[model samples]
Target: MRPFAVNRIPRWISGAVLVLWAFCVVYPVFWSIMGSLKDNQQFFNGKAWALPKFPLLWSNFSYTWETYHFGRYFVNSIVVTVGSMALALLLSATTGYVLARYTFKGSGLLYYFYISSLMIPAILTLVPMFFLFDTLHLTNSLTGLILLYAIGALPFGIFVIMGFFKSLPRELSESATMDGASHYGVFLRIMLPLAMPGLITVSIVNALSFWNEYPLALILMNDPGRYTLPVGLAVMQGEMQYRTEWGPLFAGLFISMVPILLLYAIFQSRINEGLVAGAVK
Candidate 1:
């Protein structure tokens, strides 16, 4: 038999495919950054593929911050994201710990019931949620938004943290118990520290979800001052008119994305570690 080339396809074709994938992922970020430097005239008249001839970053950033009152929106987003994540972490950590460490009647049934909630579409519950929140006068408040976000985030956080907690060694807790540590002490000093990566992962996931939340925020918060970034940005459009104010719009969007991106960059290793830890055991 003649010698066969195992790789028959051209290397350049594979390279081209990889390049295309990379471009697909990064092109939007690049375009947004470039658009933030272009004037209204240049944004439309100039080629979208081309970079700005004159970068007006300072003016664009200033306009986006001032006109959109993005500072206030940013603070609101931070508060909501942080508060929701805190609540999510607390609830998830406790739930996961209980499910993992104990063997009680109906434990499996309870876990199944909790996980089943994730199957239902969040939009389906919006009416009931809104009615409940309205009844409590939680409508149009930051606390209401945080509470709503935390509730929505709970299922996934509990699921993810449950996997991590289940993967943990029971021997550690056994040792803690031998040393006379109580259930609360073992959880607080041992389990929690060991599960830090999972907690951080839950926090990041909940924060991102809360930051990008719109539908609930739209219904709950009527005040413009309490608007998160997504809501504030949506209001920037004027009466079905497509204004070519790409500079400020892009600047606002770019700024809005920075915190989450930075967070992912900083804690990416921990996220990966938690994922691998969960997957292995």
Candidate 2:
């Protein structure tokens, strides 16, 4: 048998493509970080690509946090994202487990309904949702925003988790049941742990979406003090029309992205695992 030989040209081409893609992703984030360290003059004086000025203005972050109430907005974002993600995971896991394991008459119908919802554009529901929330006296409330975020994430979460649950061997549940484990016990103890990769993947995806969500948050949170980070950033940009504090604005934007970056970095391995699992199974 002949040994395989390296394809140098194709390898070089692939390397170049990857390098370009990395640059495209990294440069904007790098620029934003550097911009946040400089003052407005440096940011606007066609020096965005230039080295930041000496004595970096790290105070820009503080100004953004204190003057613009970015701290409050940041807290609000954390609360909403965490709360919504927790609710979404619980609901999706339970629903996905039942759909994957059971043979009830309407189970297939319900699963398809969730799958179909992914096709419906969320914007189409805005007006009706607004009226519904208003009628429920939930508009302008963090709880309302949290509920909306969780519900919005449910379809995708269920889809992902259902695949994982279905991929597991039937013997696992059967053995647990033979040992006198209740359905709830089999799920909570045996199945949920096995589904960790999918849960982590869904959590990261939903967290990023909830963290960066702007439109629904803007409409729901009327009080300035209740605004999430994205809405606060928009308000900050609007203020920039009068006074161009580009540095601090970029600082706020950079801050907004850090949590998501950190989240992906931490769960990146599980993300890959979940994707591969879904694909293979």
Candidate 3:
């Protein structure tokens, strides 16, 4: 009984720690939602923990959407996220599959090259990339942004997806090939389906980055019409300085959070499963 009670003490401590961490994360989001409902006085006054008052200011969302052209930004973000995610996943899958399965001259070097690229500070290359984009006429365009994002995260996606490929039982691919399946057929029908978890993980990770990216968009999206959500939000925040409109700002933040929350909620289980399985492999 003494040993059992002592073991339970660690469990109790861990549970308490998790609960505290959860509160730390969730309470601020809850407070922000409540803040979105209140006027500046109730929000910034001495009632930070209090619930919103009666007659919720739902107009905050409407006003921001219409007046600030957030609707346009929302659509642009959707387009960029989807387009870049699809392109990145496809490229990563194909590249990772070959690299993980086949050993060719310089394959090791090439993989290391990608892994090493992660070390170079990304910010350092921004100015050079911007000049290259300008030279090639790739600036001020969503397509250019999509291409940049797709290439930018390719190393990470390749690393993750390659692990999935290497971990998979080679018997599956060999069995498919024995039945007259070509390499493409084996990959498309067998290996690709088995690697869904890695695919989802890569897409979700890149989707979040592409959705929230700002610095590149800030430099390239020179035209107001081409602004992504983060850039648009920054612009809005600047304009809001004189007005002090915290309500709409909070509302926009809430809006920005919805897609990411939904994405994780939908694919939460798969993400953990993929990481664990790939790690073991």
Candidate 4:
């Protein structure tokens, strides 16, 4: 076989595989959105892939928002996701800075400890965490959920941020210190802004994870009113099984997807830059 022909074979195979993977991921999403525009009878009686009839049922989204209390759940998810990201970013940035910049006693041990936490499956800790939170009267509360997400996400955040911080030249911090900058000033003015790429990447990653997280949210949020979007959607699905409002169910799923999609769309460049820089460094 010609050298070019041999090389083209793998390229073609890889391209085909990627196209198939893309279809697998995107087709269901497209189907859900289309199905959301349909009504129960059309969705069930008509072909699964058929387009909605003229004058789409846009009301399904409204019904989901008002009738099913998804509005409350949506707000709860926003609050929890934002709060968790803020808390996690703060903790990760500070801890990562210390680990990267200073050679304090046991700092290596501490850094490894954080990294080690990432190895353990979160499911293993769920029961113990639930009991601990219950003791603190934090169960079924948004605040508790936020804290849990922050803590759960911390290990990976620190790992990513620390790598970025470590890649920076020591002279940057030293020069800032010589120019009458305090440790706080250097960190706040110099390091933090410089580390924006990593922080953005971490925030986007954690946002997606927290937004889609279901099992822990299900376990923590016992009150119907406290449900986040994922938990709320699951509960709504269960309730709708008998009622079989497929359109509204798919509508709820689409609504839950909007924020995260918008988030990724906005920060996609930053995420790519961060990952590339991290990998290069």
lDDT of each: 0.82, 0.89, 0.86, 0.89
**What does candidate 4's lDDT look like per residue over 1-281, in tens digits?**
65664577899999999999999999999999999999988977899889999799999999999999999999999999999999999999999999989999999999889888777998997899889989999999899999989988888788889988988889999998999999999999999999887888988888888999998998988998999999999999999757889999999999999998898789888766655543442
Write one digit per residue (lDDT tens) for candidate 1, span 24-90.
9999999998888888788678888888885455688888898779888999999999998898888
Q: What is the TM-score of each candidate against the true structure?
A: 0.89, 0.90, 0.88, 0.91
Can you rank all candidates by lDDT, best first? 4, 2, 3, 1
lDDT of 3: 0.86
Flag regions of model 4 displaced more than 4 Å.
1-3, 7-18, 269-281
lDDT of 1 at 91: 84
Candidate 1's TM-score = 0.89
Kindly report which residue pairs in candidate 3 clash with one another: none
Instruction: Give the lDDT of residue 73 in candidate 4.
Output: 96
Deviating ranges (above 4 Å) for candidate 1: 1-5, 238-244, 269-281
Model 1 Cα shift for residue 188 (angstroms): 0.5
| Candidate 2 lowest-lDDT run of ten | 272-281
What TM-score does model 2 achieve against the real structure?
0.90
Q: In model 2, how large is the Cα lDDT of residue 81?
A: 98
What lDDT tens digits, residue by residue, belong to model 3 across residues 135-254?
A: 989888899999889989888888889988999998999998899999999999999999887888878878878999988889988888888899989998898868888888888877
